[model samples]
Target chain A: MIGATRHYEIDIDKVDHMSKQLTEEEKSQIYDDIKEFLSEELDVPADQITPQSKIIDDLNGDSMIYLELVEMFKKRFDVNVEVRLIGQYFQRHPIYTVGETAQAVYDIVERGDNLLADEDKASV
Target chain B: MDQGIELVELSALTAPGVEIALIDIERHPHLEDAADQFLEPDERARFVTLRSPHRRREWLAARVCAKLLAARKGLIAGPHEARIAQDRSGRPALVDPAGRAVTGITDCSLSHKGRFACACLGRPPIARVGIDIETVSPRLRSLRDAFVNPSDAMEFHVDTDADLALLWSLKEAYSKAIGAGLHIGLKNITSNRNPATNSLRVRTLAGRVAHARHVVYSNCVVAVCFIAQ
Candidate 1:
């Protein structure tokens, strides 16, 4: 039944990170993490995943899935994401590519940690 | 005296020579929505600005107390002038506004249900008062862990006919009496039915605050906390 769902592949290169840049290797790792999460949560094969997959429509993920994803991301990346803002971001600037969504998330974490590090250095 | 309401006969804690009146809406002019024209300019603005019925009840209760005082030719002109201030937890109190000594601690607590709103006013004899009436529902039985203190859980004993709703109400009233609200945490306070006094023993952070509990209507439970000044 899972195989019957239309398989979509996520193209990692399409996303424009602008000045907030993430290396290709870092971006690839994000895809690996998100792919593992989606496979386990949806009970679908890894090859069936796509970046353009609508979380609710294509992946059949609910609020609980989003919450689980949020927890998984926080635990894995050590970044704080407001649960309320997650739904809004997914609806507009979607992760149409596998690594793009996770890459976006990684860049955010990297920037936040760097800012905190700068503050600590300044204080010292 | 509301047709839907069964007016459980409640005794008011009136002071010596001070007048107190308990008028049911059915007996009065259905003054639930009635505005006090005698309000001061500031009071009028404040009262008008209030949007919620629950908030309006607090203001109306104070106004009603002021009117009752004025009728008796008391010292205070209006309820707002009756030295009303909020406790730390934001529970309202009628305190001495000026540094000068208050005539006596005239405190009042308002409770309303459906269409009937009741205000309990008293002097120093009745120090701190807190009352709560909760509508009994099947929901209380399922969600018992949320409100019930672990110690009180066994006492609740959800049998074929357990009144967990009333138990919850008594617990709430006890907390309100301390002016702590729910922030003090319900688990900190213990509630036990004292067979001797026929009142619930509500243990607080400091000591046990005596409670007078009553179950009214099959749908509701009422508990009042009595603290000595």
Candidate 2:
């Protein structure tokens, strides 16, 4: 059932940019980890996780899971993504699939430090 | 009153036939142990797999509260005699000792927030019922646009965090009552306030209407919904 539902198109440009920062092997490994995590968290079969599966509609997940996923990305990638920024991003662009979530995690890992610093400065 | 739903305290709803149980998750230091006594084998397995302590506590509290309510309603001999299972849409249903769906015989809904869990039970003919409790917080304001319907946003004026929390809880209660949850988006559920009675008339996009009653306790807003008979 994975990759069965397609609502939004993947940003190939962003994917290409992410590819430069992380190796193809690393990306595949990250995707595998995400699929495993979600499968276990949602109690769904791993085979059902597709790049196009709707996180809420298909996976039976909620906003809290999205926030947790962002935190997981930060810890797994050793980056500093602001929780508030990730929350706002999810609100604006509700993630639907494993692929979209992976892309969002990759983008955050690539620019997390700068974003966290900017958020800190803005607070001051 | 909107649809004749009288707002009352959780305690007030407790009567001979109707059973309501409220559990303070924080007060029970050994809720995990108590919860185990109530959960069936399948429920226990699921409970073991919960990664978050908070989630586990809430799950346990809700199940325990449900079991207590079921016992009080005489649907089961004890907590272990009943099993709570979710349908395809993830709505919890009561299974009798004979392993038959008892939802037709009894109606139950569970809601929890922070350290509080509430379970409300009604007999047959009250097939659809929902209860939700949410802590009053500023976060409700930020998530308002995502859930509050435009019609409700304009008709039901929310001036403070408490008001927003009540509105969100009302929507959640209604959704759970309909057994659709958020599948029926919060924005799809409309609310019309009856200030004179301090209640609201809520309608779902699916054309189901329910009367919601709420009360505030310990910084939390609790709402319950029942389909008009």
Q: Which sections of candidate 1 miss by over 4 Å? A: A1-124, B1-9, B12-33, B37-42, B53-84, B95-102, B157-162, B205-207, B215-218
Question: What TM-score does each prediction get for chain A alone?
Answer: 0.54, 0.70
Candidate 1 clashing pairs? A51-A96
**What docking grade does candidate 1 earn?**
incorrect
Evaluate residue A57 in candidate 2 and report its C-alpha lDDT on the 0 to 100 scale: 51
lDDT of each: 0.50, 0.68
- Candidate 1 scores a C-alpha RMSD against the true structure in Å of 15.0
Tens digit per residue, CA lDDT, model 2, A22-83: 65766776787778878987787999789887665566564545655665656555565445
Q: Largest DockQ belongs to which candidate? A: 2
The clash tally of candidate 1 reads 1
For model 2, residues B1-229, the per-residue Cα lDDT tens digits are 0112112237643433345667887778677765656778898888876644676787777888877767655677777778888875567877876678664345678887777888877665565778888888775554555566667657666767887888888888887888764445566777787889766778876678886777788999888777634
Question: Interface root-mean-square deviation for each candidate?
Answer: 16.5, 11.5
